[model samples]
Target: MPEVKNEHIKAILAIVPEKPGCYQYFDEKGTIIYVGKAKNLKRRVHSYFNKEQDSNKTKVLVKQIRDIKYIVVDTEEDALLLENNLIKQYRPRYNVLLKDDKTYPCIVIKNEYFPRVFQTRNIIKDGSKYYGPFSSVFMAKTMLQMLRELFPLRTCKLPLTPESIANGNYKVCLEYHIKRCLGPCQGLQTREDYDKNIRIIKEILKGNIAQVSNYLYEEMQQLASNLKFEEAQKIKEKYDIIENYRGKSTIVNHSLTNIDVFSFDETDSSAYINYLHVNNGSIVQGYTFEYKKRLDEAKEELLGLAITEMRTRFNSLAREVIVPFLPDVDMSSTVTFTIPLKGDKRKLLDLSKQNVKQYKLDQLKQAEKLNPEQRTTRVLTTMQHDLQLHALPVHIECFDNSNIQGTNPVASCVVFKMAKPSKKDYRHFHIKTVVGPDDFASMNEVVYRRYRRLLDEEEPLPQLIVIDGGKGQLNAAVDALRSLDLIGKIAIIGIAKRLEELYYPDDPIPLVLDKNSETLKVIQRLRDEAHRFGITFHRSLRSKKQVLSELDSIKGIGEKTKVALLSHFKSVKRIREADQEEIWKVVGVAKGNLVIAGLKQASDKIKESKEK
Candidate 1:
């Protein structure tokens, strides 16, 4: 703003009063750029121009400020709340913007005689009843499904009146045949029965499930007494289903009637709130929401704004509210707020707190996914905790032995940097020092060769080493580290495939971590990767060795001839399948007949075995 450094702003700053208040900054175009609150308006407003701001955003905000406005409040909380309202109304440029204007889910009873009970997001000004602004849409749908099962309410969208039914304006569909509906549209069910079911549904929606359950139980018993076993069984199924859903959803198991519960957690630029609507002994609605803080507003101020917005948006008319604390807002005479000190109400608040905290954690994890370094740090930290290691495994190496029936033994060392496979850093060992399919010996040799090179070359070593085997392999790998006087410098553990048991050297008992733990998953990933790498290399060697042995068995294929035939045909199977002329060309004419005859003899033996 050209007038940012002008006399008017300076004069206003000079005359700014000392009081708790909200302030707004305007740019050259007369657009509000930022809004802020402070206990002492003069000092807070003056500090912006007097001190150098560290944040680029703040500095830019000051540079654009051509004019300022203020509103004084009696208390600091009032200043906070006023700031929130101003920022939201103007959506000031420098404010932290809430991207999700979250709308809650509510079960709406449509105004029709046969009211449609289903979840809706908005409360339209139609003559209808809304039960809850539920915290979860899934919870609302689940409740609706249970209610449908119990009442067999109409699913069709037809306007059924006495006159329409008398004129035969509707036909009953498959809902009646399947016993899912009482055919209210076609007058197979009376208005009284349908209205009665609707009333019962409303009662249940208001957390009066016990009354409905008792009525259903008594009805089921009456039907069973009349030998209507099929109908009785259907009623019993619904009884189980409704009770099961109630048992799962009702956390505290007792009712808190007509109350709204709010719990919160905060982040750098946001406040998160979990809202639960309790009626009778059940939570009928739940929702977690976030509000952006403009000008670094206090939690209390942000929370008040969120509560007002949510209540207005959801049309909540609960007489009582359970909150973490009383917000700085004018209260209506009809509504009272409570901060529970003990018992079930306290439990409900805690549940809401836990929800918002978890929601905040989830948001952080989502951000971490976009940042590789953050994800790496998280994984390493988790690994350290789960494995009880002294340090983070910034660089991790896992070893797996691969050999089949005492032949072509090999081991692989797979390296991971920040919980991700570092393919170029991976190493394959040919097991030169170990004879036979000795996995333990192979592990020892590979470990020795790996760290010994790192030691000689003055390269950094991994903080953790994983051996893909049970205790024996772990001991063998540890011995190699011990040989280099580096056992204590690094952490090593072994994973057994069968049970995924983790073994530490010199410890008799293995540590079993939860299957879902992040640390255990990382270890499992490293182990599986090592096994795959080693098995690939081992299979290649075995295939080459087998081909060499088979080609060497051919009578005319001497060492040089064998090499020529192998190179040309690639394998014994290829040589066997080749035309005699092709074989003659590779082995030469003089020895071609002998080679063909030997091949025929082998083929005959294989055919005879299969025939038997």
Candidate 2:
């Protein structure tokens, strides 16, 4: 290949195996920049240089390869697992980066004579049993509290060896006095009983609470049959507690056990995956994580990577896994992949999907919170993609027309810069050329006048223009842009009021975005703002016209006289309510008498019309 200039890379490619394996690419400094898994090492490695890469990222990655290395495996699953390990170990620049960094807490039963149960973040390989890497420490602590309440396990750090207890070297602390512990250190509780309780605790941590509840119920019944009323009452209370905890843990049918559910959500540059570990119908563990993509990885590929990563991280051993879709991974015959439809399994899958979506949203909100400019860039990027625009719409303008039965017709133009309303740049237009309630004509006139003025003044044109009506008004605005040869210069869209459908110039079918999409929200805001501004201007003009016609038609009442009357009374209705004595005090009796006589004549005409 012409692009494969490195002699060393060509040499490694010549002898690479045809078996399933992973490959790593290195730059001039001999640092690995990319790692990839392939079913056939030779074919996948050669495929990179064999064709003209479509993705700019892939093309750049291919150009930086100076050395190549491959490790062959027996199966595609093994290759994927190995690739995941190598990526974590090296964290290559061109590999999908796992974004999780915090270590969650786990409840551990420490390896001791009488094992101590507590919450810890560190996992030691000293034969101690660890229940969970719980989502939060609060959850771990809650489980610990429940266990301590159910069984009086020791809460002290004193050594509980048989020798120490036999010699009476340890003393029972306040925990034993309060009956919170069985005083195992002082030999008051035998090791056998404590170990029995530990076994039941393990079962509970595994989400097998029903088993423990059944055992407790039988014991409580035995105690009551023996006529031991007080002891039986205590056992009954423990049984009830176990039953309540079990009810809270059961999320689905008990038959749904040892299952792993996965769901996927993604954006342009990243993929998010949620995992739910269900045991005996209960969600024992759940996690959602993000993968920052390096290349244009397919959904199936990313899903495969995520499944491998999580399964290894959690050490999941379930034979059956529920997923939204079958990932492109080759597993052994022992494991089964299920795409569930309309059942408890489907409910778990839905829950997983919901979690992934919420996680994606929260991650975005947090990032935008830290960097306000990021939200603007993201919104404009979404707009650019949805509208199929060639560039970001940093500056946008929307037009709307308002008229009450063709009276006081006016139009408004609202400006949005960086996806926010630019109030100072907003403009209002009175319908000069159009004399009726013709929205199409008014839109055309306003658009032409607005842009023509901007063109004359050598101002920068907006990247997008939104017309607040469907096909007709949109076409009118398009014609205005065409007159100035700006049709292809700016992206324009029309939004219909009925369904919020978006219309383009040539495309008859409108593009409807998701209801929650930022692009749709911004467009809706612009349309609503333009409509509000136009309506406000229209109302003011109508009110002004009504005042002029009523007061200016009088014989002696001129501009100054009209201002004096309005300034004193604030409104015509109030002036009409005032008596002649009140009017005389404001505008002098001579003009005031004429004003009172004129207003009284107008009010009498209105009353006569209503009577007819």
Candidate 3:
């Protein structure tokens, strides 16, 4: 491990070409430590080793360079583009990498005769109408539920066929019976009627709500003219549903058609910003991003970087991005960046800034209540420094496993974003490949599956990975990451409860935190959360196994009948108390008779045992 001297810099510069290119610095183990680009490859490459030009950040970069690699390009701009791509791909430790950890579900309508509308995270080339990139899957599903109520859309996965339609073999789902769907599978609605509803849905999603309301009003008039009073009344009910939403829209400005207002503020160690999306003179959506980093740079520079990162991540960039302060750098032509000072635009910017202030206040209050010791924030700050991360670990994820002996092994990954538990991001995994109570192997499988999916999808990966064990568990996670070529890309730590210790890969002894320290408490909180989640999943598995075993002993009860019985009554205790008539109602007469007989025999056996 020889020190990287000026000679190493000269060697790199001598080999570097004059053409525009991107460069990477690798450590001794061939891990990418830093990535950079330059207009003149030789000049930029030499600047790093120049003794007089070195800052602390640059000095750290130089010390990590054991070897250099470069990719030549034709132009400077091309080099810049490639540099961004490579930085994102490798996520070098020193680069100001864009951290996009937020994801939302969208409502997609596929291009087909029977177009399906569903919630999805993926945007593929399968010609579909996507309405949103919504903040959460719950929000997307709520909107979908509302859409189903207004339009009798089909949610069934059954393939369309004339035979199935005529036979009515597929029972109408609860949605259809509750009037949320028109029972299209049962051939209850004509194609003309369904298409009309779908067209209205498309119009609403396209921000053409006035057109949809007007069309519904005209239809209502026609129904009344034809003396179909009942049909006219039904049309009026639909009109009310559309009307109710009209008042929910908050008008930012009467003149502004579509615009986005952005405002940002920063503390010594964190950044907070808000984006307000205004469409059709109304505020449609709002987003807030809390960035964590020491404010070593100017506010203008931070704001510019935040804007660029947001534009790169969010697909729905507004026509104009209104900001409170104008940066010295020139923005690309895709968006018109403006600094509004004196008019309605200025007021909107102020309002967005106020939103940022309120958001920070709310976060502080929440942090106090959630972790009184402020351990969550301290832990995030410590991890950020230890890993030399560009941003603080606002979104921390931890994994734990649970099993009794060698059966019912289950694992869970819980997320804490912004010092709060984001249960929506919590994931549960039933040990798929590994059997028995092997914690190390089970954890390795979980980490591999989770990150592999993220890599394949090109989605944002978590900032940190916390496992629930000591050296073995930490090493297992490291091995999994190495296999995927992502070992150094993510920071991994493990917590074992014996002495309340934290284990890193290179360290032999576990690092124990003071019980009174806020940082230690945060780690304990995350560890406990992972444990709770894993145990909850394991208990559910055990309960399900018990239910299946009990059902297996009964005669004339197969999997389907057992499922139906349990689903209807919800519990075995409830089913045992149900009379013959109630059982018939649950599984229908023919199947119900067999269930009743089995229940009677089981009951008789219990009675005989009691007598003995």
List per-prediction Cα lDDT, in the order shown: 0.78, 0.82, 0.73
TM-score of each: 0.52, 0.51, 0.37
Best by TM-score: 1
lDDT of 2 by residue, 315-360 (tens): 9999998989988787657569999887568777877786687667
- Cα lDDT of candidate 3 equals 0.73
User: Runs in model 3 with CA error above 4 Å?
Assistant: 1-379, 386-391, 552-579, 598-612
Write the residue-wise lDDT of candidate 3 on 1-612 in tens digits. Answer: 233465544445555567675787888899988877789877888777654543688777777778776655445643554465466557788887432322245678877556778988666656667665453466667767767767778877777666777887777789888887777787887767888878888776554667778988999999999999999988888887777653211222234647877888766677788876665333444556788775477777777777777666665667788898875446666778888777557766776786677556555655555566575566577767654566777877898888888888889999988667899999999899996789899989999998899899997877777888888988998899989998767778888888877788898866766778665677788899999988988889898887766577777667888888888888877887888799888778887777666666877988999999
Q: Which residue window of length 10 is worst by lDDT in model 2? A: 246-255
Number of clashes found in candidate 3: 1
Per-residue CA lDDT of model 1 for 61-100, tens digit only, reads 8888898866544456445544544565578888884213
Q: Flag regions of model 1 displaced more than 4 Å.
A: 1-261, 266-321, 324-366, 433-436, 551-568, 573-612
Error of 2 at 168 (Å): 66
Candidate 1 collision pairs: 134-285, 134-286, 135-285, 135-286, 135-287, 254-281, 255-280, 255-281
